[model samples]
Target: AAALEAYDGHERVWCGRDEERGLVALVGIHNTALGPALGGTRVWPHESFEAGMTDVLRLSRGMTYKAAVAGLPFGGGKAVIIADPKKDKTEALLEAYAEMLVALDGQYYTGEDVGLTLADADFIRERAPNISGTSKGGSGNPSPVTAEGVFLGLKAALAHKSGSDRLAGVLVAVQGLGSVGWSLCEKLHAEGAELVVADIDTDAVDRAANTFGARMADAGDILFVEADILAPCALGGLFSSDTIPQLKAGIIAGAANNQLARHEDARLLMERGILYAPDYVINAGGLMNVAAELAPGGYNREATMRKVTEIPRTLTAIFQKADAEKRPTNEVASDIAMARIADKRS
Candidate 1:
């Protein structure tokens, strides 16, 4: 505890919990350079306490740098709740977690991520004033914005990695069909890209396969599907050495954050001749647009388009730097984001 000071440095950090309602929350605060920490709350059925801790801490830190790199006014922070979305969501549980968050004052602000919804967030906000990403009478769902960013990044990856700016016949294997994945698939399908989709939710899998004539795979088989691109719209760290050995894809670009099993895996992907689009970099588009909505007159669609499309440019630059210096792309990108974060000493 004495040694863990920086948010990114702590692999296991404590995020207060609500025992009465059996809700476990892990909050990761990456930086406060711009202002108070801002992040989203992701609820999932986690297997262990350690997994929850590792995810929250890493994601929170990623948010910090993501915001910094995107030039947003918010700091990085993330919250994770341990529970199966299908089995364990209760109003009492959410309110209890909200109470825990309210106790933090304004040091951390939460929006919605992954398993949590805007409505769920609003339920939490009933008790905790710190949550963001609600309907608020007009914001609509965040999935479209997030998917838009991912689409732009995918275009970038295809151009940078596949040596073709067109995805007309590219084989793209998508691992999830949630709001983000579904919209992303739509964009890819409309672009004439062939798609193979998978998801734990049978309804979602069936919808995508039926609507778009996509080939479907078993949930676990999503990883090994032979394709040109693997889009992980589901979760993080699916790119472990074990899984890496199974993939025959040329590139990986998705909306999920923190996709590496470990940070070093970024280089491992490179070593295997797979061009990796840094998850945080590509996924920053939605958050950037969200932050814009908080500004005066909301967001400017044209301006946001120009800014969001820059994700690939940034990734391309990082790839070039890594190639020139013969270093890992992750290291160069981290250094860039870290330099902008506030330096703190304990």
Candidate 2:
């Protein structure tokens, strides 16, 4: 009932329990006016059932806007299995989760997200056919595409701030060495950007340093580091009342979803002269990649990349509108996404 109160016009929400496998899952279909609702499956250890539901609700809504702004013929939906991936993930649990998705029919489709991977997607596909980002489907991993979009979005933010989009010689503080972060670091390094990388995972951090020559920073200090851009490629809510005042970076952009702890943080960053690339808009590359598989003539890598290339243009448009209206970029982005959803409803 509390979850329903927080629905935000969600089309449907389902909660399932698999006692046999000790699995609990929630699926939220935020919208489907454009087409079927599509998002990713996230498996994580949630403190409570409500927390897991909230995650699905929030992420599913983000997917709606992400698909709308990215011009995909899909709505937004998300699934979450409440368990620690390291210790709780078993083949039986994954298969049970897949069965839950199947029960929903074709209304929702899923791919990979945090705590889930392509291999997991493959496992889910055995029980559910409406899955994307499978190795068999030729989509491969979505991280590289996601990172590519973030790289371009960051460039657009840089152009908005300094009148030059060149990344060479620019200092970047990347606060996550995950797949997306690592790929983003590679792109930044290729463009000669000075990198300071950090992650809770020591191996990931070490790999970034060894592979890309990124200087290592402790996770606690990465947010406050004095750099031209702060790339949050990890968890959300890094920008808050306490951290906003401490941010020394001129621009905030990365692959992480929900970077702001609260909506008002957008205004705080704007007042501080920090340009932010709205998370969903900048991180739509994976969606773009998978949406290609649904293309009428089948997936084409070149065509899919062409769509991914439009991300910078989208960010530039948001920045332009924000400037014209004297509003935070986040607000502008929300307006754009909401307007599209409204249009479809109308």
Candidate 3:
């Protein structure tokens, strides 16, 4: 009940524990008005159960808005496994988590998120059928598709901020070099953008520097780098009152979820003249790809790509609406998403 207090308007939240197998997980189903909840399973080394709960709640709610805004026939849901994927992930642990998905009985369909790979999705698929992003029959790794969406959305932000959207000579500071971030860098580099990158993985950062001629910055300093754009492809809650005042980028657009620590952070960005592409609106490509697997005719890469291409259009509309209303982009995007969800419910 105490945990429920934190969930507020969520539809359902499942907590699973298996001490013998060293399994602890939380799955939050935020809404299902559009369809069954479809989101990814994120495995992270959370500090405590309460921390994991907070993450799951916020991520699940974001998933709901993501689906609604992306115009996908799905609702929002997310799962979090409380452990380090490197040291604690095991076959037994995955098997126990699979059982929890089984118990969900189709209310939620999950794929891979941070700290998870396509191989991990395959392992989970062996025990549970309610999973996407599997190598065999699912959409495979969604990083590239996700990167494509972010790239397109970033262009929209650039076009809205300035009259031109060309990436040539634009300096972009990317804050992470994971699969999606690396893929995004490839796209940005191909478009002639100058890259300033940072990552905890030295090898990944080195590769970016060598391949894209990127200048490497410390992970902590990447956020404050004096660049035209800041792409935060890492974790969430990076933008708050304190950090917003220090931002040097004119635009903030990335694949990270929940970039703002609070709702008011959007207003802060607005006041500071930073154009923010709402994380969920810009990062729905992965969800769209995985949702393709659930289509009656099965996954179609071409069709999915067509849908992903519309991300820029969606962002452009949001930008225009925000400008006309003199409101923050995040708030405008959220209102549009909620209106869509409400229309469906009505």
Candidate 4:
């Protein structure tokens, strides 16, 4: 990082090509001093070039700290293939995408992300060498490990804020019940937390209600629910000015990244006594999990868990620095990460 003075140039290489399935966009090689750049390939519906660029760059930068904070040797990088996964998936399109990744010569490793799946990764892996996250035996989804990180992060945030690790009697409202959110809901339920579950998917809601016995609510109503913790495990920007006033939660910790609508959103939360676990820092478990697998065989799971759990530690340190220095925590954290990059570059 710029402050740590640990690495060299953070040169970003890219490949964008259009075929039958819209665009195959690839951004590669963030920093190699720690090692090659390994990250997931996310396919999403993007309306503009800016959307794709923002996602890849931010996700790449996140990978850096995700690996750094998780103590892995690899640096961070991510690829975004911009298109509607629902409308434009085809064998030919994926094959062309794989050909592009294969051209990278092991410089970039691709896996699964929001709009992508293991099957897609496997398709890409056939043509691209060095890509991973397709399990050898193919046992389960990565959402659980992702959920694990979020759960641990919530525990850390809970302990940091309330001085307790237990979630019993703690009221939690979870947004979305997708793979990761559903997994997180189970964890919260197991911890004895009172749960309010919401999802756009009726099937997912019904399943949670039947299996986990979670109370269901209208999806839009979840953000405004009165609760102890509001986990935005769905999409980003659920914490903007319009929704902040309606929030009754004391804590904002969940799997969603980029939850802030703008820089001022943090101040809003702080004013409301809602300690948000800086979206990227708290939900970094999936990144850490993949990075752990890429490390040498002796990768410590407990150490990895400790690393993810330390997110609150990093966050609290940032908040304390902000308070003493009279700056925003976002400013402080960005300054720290960029300083690490600058130091390393110099």
Q: In lDDT terms, how accurate is model 4?
A: 0.72
Q: Write the per-residue lDDT of candidate 3 for residues 226-318, one digit (tens) a residue.
A: 999999998998999989999999999999998998867899999998999999999999999999999889999999999999999999999
Q: Compared with the true structure, what per-residue lDDT tens digits does model 2 show for residues 162-221?
A: 999999999999998887998899899999999998998889888888988888999889
Q: What would the C-alpha RMSD of candidate 4 be, to one decimal place? A: 4.7
Residue 148's lDDT within candidate 4 is 80
Candidate with the greatest TM-score versus the true structure? 3
Among all candidates shown, the one with the greatest lDDT: 3
Query: Against the unseen true structure, what C-alpha lDDT does each candidate score?
Result: 0.79, 0.89, 0.93, 0.72
Q: What is the TM-score of each candidate against the true structure?
A: 0.90, 0.96, 0.98, 0.84
Error of 4 at 97 (Å): 1.6
- Model 4 stretches astray by more than 4 angstroms: 1-10, 13-15, 21-23, 26-35, 137-141, 298-329
Give model 4's TM-score versus the native structure. 0.84
Q: Candidate 1: misplaced stretches above 4 Å?
A: 1-7, 10-14, 296-303, 342-346
Off by over 4 Å in 3: 1-6
Report the C-alpha displacement of residue 168, candidate 4, in angstroms.
1.1
Which residue window of length 10 is worst by lDDT in model 4? 1-10
